[model samples]
Target: MNFKRFLKWLAPVSLTAILILCTIVQGWSAPTAAQTQLHWYGQSAFKLTTPTGKVILIDPWITNPVNPNGKTDLATLNRADLILVTHGHFDHVGDAMTIAKKTNAPLVSTADLGQALVESGYPKNLVTLDTQGNFGGEISLLNNEVKVAFIPAIHSSVIASDGSPAKYAGNPGGFLVTVQNGPTIYHTGDTDVFADMALIPRFRKVTLMLACIGDRFTMGPQRAATAVGYVKPDRVIPMHFGTFPALTGTPAAFAAELKQQRVGSRLQVMKVGETIRL
Candidate 1:
């Protein structure tokens, strides 16, 4: 065969080979059909698993009052990529240090609270500035698979010391987590229903809201329903309630209020240790 004829045949074959290789690479790089899983442990403790298998725990009070299998759940936590704490209270900060040490998950919180956690014996290496942010600040993490925004909350944050007086942690806040292929979750840490809650939808559409409906420390059913009316998320999951006697708010009351107030958001009352695929 002539050299020119050979080159022409080789060029077309190479082009076809290259096209096939590109298709294979694209298919391999594409994500699988893995659904995001959200597990509620009780009293605001939740484990969120992304579609790519990254795990995020928020207010990890794994051993709270309402969860019967707290110890087992804590022991079985094999993977955790991020641990987010809205405040320094024992309930919200519960088992964070242990989980971080075990999984090497970085602590994502306010700068002051992160430092306070380090001082309180949390792993110093994991509480870096890369994961810390203040209210109205947002940080992209996990190769842009997730974005966490710190939102203000009308509450107090003090880290209790063993011998010394309780130290100021930082301003209390909430978390708005936007997952790449998953839902946007808003965790309203221990806070009363504030007017600014209405502004949350201005940033992004919230898929799920973890609200606090316990009366003594946070908003009760009525106020929480009002807050839901403000945020107007697609679905609302009640949290920070039913762990103590003072937390008198019930999910039934919340649902009734939602109906009475004419809110369009759907109420999802997750059972302890239950995992919901989103």
Candidate 2:
């Protein structure tokens, strides 16, 4: 073909190719629909992923007695935007400092406990004032993708230093986490059942309740079932049990109690290292 004819043919063809390439690139770069996910690591440790992919860890005792893969889970945790510590017990505060250092995730707890953790070697910069709150206070975080409300719990909280006496960390509490476009979750820190629990459902409808059913430390199956009746969550997952011999509150017992109480909530018993989509 002549040069002039070749140029004429190349112009439209090149334009068509550019348009097709642009379309393909745009499609590939577009954001995908986000789904919320939850992971339990036995005891009271739980990992929650918001629809926007922000990660939140509650009572992050990932390497607990019941979780055989606790070390693996901790090592593989790539992202953590916030770490919510309900109390200062060793089991509940498991690996918080290590995880905060690794992921640079800020600490969300009562003002006193946050300061105590900082004194106990958690990164001072990560446990800033903005991340701390007291009971009845709610903090909006992760660009408003999550709202964490500090709720009271019937338990004790003391922080013990290395080979030293235990000191008062703060009042014990639970977390009422509201995720944007996702389910609202209530993690009842280490506590026994209280009548005030009925007040929780008045504020927000609970999607899932992570309840402690271990008898010696927290509420047994009977009291836990009663607590569930008060909060009235759509689903209930038993935790803080089967880690030690004293924690004899089995899921079977909890299920039987739930049936006996005629609680409408569905009991979801998650195994160690299991992840579920909400």
Candidate 3:
């Protein structure tokens, strides 16, 4: 146990201990609590609040033909701690940039999508942004308790103009969001029930799922129910329905299918502007 040799061994060990301690302090004590509130603004838009009060908005397509009075259109409803875009559809990004400009929130999306937004009129100076592509990659926010993983989905990823081909923006995707204190939430932006749905991270363990059951464009009630059966989330919230008359699928139909398939108990049908707390 010579003095020089002992000191060399102790140095690395001490540094490792300090690093681990710092991570724990930063993740737990730095924030008084984990996220606690889950608010559904209809369709795929939702507001999540960590116990420490950090806000996260997902696929925030608040105003459209369906949600005419959506918070996105409301001037007072600006600002968020973080914003996530599942894909490049207009309904999912209508008010994202506006809210970011007003609140200076961080935008979490794919690199290609973020760049496209910047080119398509989003303010480049008003917000922070994080873009991570799908599978395994995660972004830790709100003191690291909340981790967001971009998951795969079968959907379109184009910003088309009148009579023009869809601009190849990027691949369409979904989100697998885990909140430390509450339920893990999944927002499947207009998608079909692909085999990959079963492979998405945190599948079936989700507490709430914002699913698209609008048939003409996405999966119909029967398929969505099957998607739910595969995901087996603790609860499911049907969305992307009733927005257009062509979208004949309804929550009622989803509910009936869920019951027929023994999943009705987990379905939570939210009103256009209702909030669901998990």
Candidate 4:
């Protein structure tokens, strides 16, 4: 073969290799409209776009401190099929009302927290009984494309707005979101390490884990690493840290601890306002 033909053959092959490498390093799949996409808005906020264009927001704190474009993202979001709030705290419940009002998204949460959100002005119709569940219960959402299970968390929950005395909002919790033809994501909400986490993978293999590494309020690097070991997800992303002075834990520290603990989970450090395909 002549040098010209050889070069032509190498070009597409080289491009394919580069794309694969990028996917491995960046935790991104091949760019396609039919792929499941995940967007992080700092803190515990996440938007998941399913393959069929259904949108689900988890702990929709769009205006958190770490997110610079919080307001813009909030305003531009025109569609939200479902909104899942792990608890009724202000931070975790951030912007849920605004988004739900605009998109008519149903709120998936424990029954007590759902009632509290409705009382706090969340759309009553949207917070219907179908979406409300308890711990150890799973609800099929978005035409069965996504299934969300209410998981227990070691945290407190209260709904307090405008300093008007906190109201009891049942228990804090996390979610196990299983996406069809996509990844099974575990959002750890704001919880410390617990033994039941070990039983999570027994049900379904976790593709991604959104874990809290913020020390003061939630699990630090060490405890978070232990939690990761229990679930053993395919990839782990650290969150709920660095938005405030009190949340001192960092992804760097979390990575070191994962290594020290001999946890085999792959760590994917997501930046605020970043999106990745799964």
Candidate 5:
């Protein structure tokens, strides 16, 4: 009613509005969110850290032959919010049960593969319907900080325990991992190049594609290059290569193939024990 009363109310309201606008408008003024981090442990194993610091491990073969520091990495890794196994192959499932037993991170995979993992010594209770899904099915986890969609991969999957026969686990698949305020990453689990990979970009643009370039098991450089062309990610990282004498695919060859295919994705070749912010 009074002029003095109105002026006091407007002053506080204007200051509050200015502060809110500053946070909303200023990109360079202050750091709004932390950058996502990615760590490679040789082979297809990777540790993805969200901007909010939640950890997701995909195909965590930490102690693969190529990673000289695998033992140390495995020993020192104490935190994992989620353990995502793309398949039931020994190499891809490496150290997952050990990590799960220690960290109690839930198993994210198809129901069959999850059951196999549980039988193979993973914490039984951690394998739940919420984290397991089939191809084309998407599940939001980590309080919605991360969302994962199972995508098809042209590969086979099986599980075996010590002194036990191998059993067919489930259909092999890859993962489309979307991190909040970070990036969408496609981890191609031990796959050959398939035509349907082109369909991935129609649903959500992939920021990074973690591709397999090992020749004997997965696609070599040339085939992987085609997969890169299909996915058309902003950046592509070659994985599952040079981990053994059999895995002769090199990043150098991969780069040449990418250039030959005229693929526009940036090739980010990470070292076995290196960590980088994305």
Candidate 6:
């Protein structure tokens, strides 16, 4: 081979080797069966099962904010080994405390929000609070291969009770969940698409990405599509839309943009109360 051609091929090979080496050192290796499955509930809620039967829930809101539903009550939902709250927003945290109390699920929320929940009559013992501003920190659960990390998201947070503000939780964020026996799931709570999102890499090629597309409160479809490109998950599920009249965003538009970006095949539009197996 010519010198120039050999150097070009060698450069690409070297780059690939370096990336693989980094991934191995950082604990990203062969994906197991758990990395192939994920399930999404409406909005920013979902259930992820590890290959070892571990379940993790992210922002489990299953009711209407304007009018609560009997079936949507989180207290009666299935057992959750780990519960993640992206922020202190009421909609995102509507049923966290109730579910935690009922299932004795360890809540993974910010310290500020955990204290606020305790003060507002939530059980203090159920919370596994961690809000020390450690952006990329991971919390390994007691059972199951479920691990959760607090990722950065540009949004506001508040804790209220009986129609009054109880606490002002600081900046909102999202959860990057990784199941040792399964796929990595990223649930973006109410947030605007920020540049830092590309910093986090999923362990198992992100089988499911639960994203918020409701404008006014969160990023619109266009910005959300851009975020989809950045995260580049295997499948993207649009949520946090069509619940309210003020929130004007739709999954169809998101899908269209994804198509334009040549990622339409990865877009999955899940209806409220509908579940998609990832």
Q: What are the TM-scores, per candidate, against the unseen true structure?
A: 0.88, 0.88, 0.79, 0.88, 0.89, 0.78
- Compose the digit string of candidate 2's lDDT tens values, residues 1-278: 99999999999999999999999998786566687899999899999999878999999999997888889989999889999999998998899999999999999999999988888888999988788999999999998889999999999998886888897889999999999999999999999999999999999999999999999989999999999999999999999999999999999999999999999999999989999998
Q: By TM-score, is 2 or 4 better? A: 4
Report the C-alpha lDDT of model 6 over 54-75, residue by residue, as the tens digit: 6667777655453244255454
- Computed on alpha carbons, the lDDT of every model, listed in order, comes to 0.93, 0.93, 0.76, 0.94, 0.93, 0.71
TM-score of 3: 0.79
Clashing pairs in 4: none
**Native-structure RMSD, model 4:** 8.4
The sequence of per-residue lDDT tens digits that candidate 1 reaches over residues 1-278 is 99999999899999999999999998786555898899999998999999989999999989987888889989998899999999998899999988999999999999999999999999999999899999989999999999999999888998896777898999889999999989999999989999999999998999999999999888899999999999989999999877988889999999999999999998998999899998
TM accuracy, model 6 = 0.78
Pairwise TM-score winner, candidates 4 and 6: 4
Stretches of candidate 1 off by over 4 Å are 1-32
Error of 3 at 236 (Å): 0.3
Model 2: what TM-score?
Answer: 0.88
> In candidate 6, where is summed lDDT lowest over 10 consecutive residues?
66-75
After TM-score superposition, the amount by which residue 206's alpha carbon in candidate 5 deviates from its true location, in angstroms, is 0.4
Model 5 lDDT per residue over 34-91, tens place: 9999999989999999998899999998999989999989999999999999999999
1 or 3: which has the higher lDDT?
A: 1
State residue 146's C-alpha deviation in candidate 2, in Å: 0.1
lDDT of 3 by residue, 1-278 (tens): 99999999999999999999998988884434443777767667877876666788887877756675765444667558888887788778767877877787777877677766676656765324444455557777767878888877788876654466666667778888888867788888788998766665344377778889989888999899988887878788888887768888988899988988886338778776665456
Pairs clashing within candidate 6: 34-181, 34-182, 35-182, 35-183
Pick out the ten consecutive residues of candidate 2 with the lowest summed lDDT.
26-35
Candidate 4 C-alpha lDDT tens digits along 51-169: 98899999999999989999999999999999999998888999999999999999999999999988999989998888989999999987789999889999999999987989999
On lDDT, the stronger of 5 and 6 is: 5
For model 5, what is the alpha-carbon lDDT of residue 278? 84
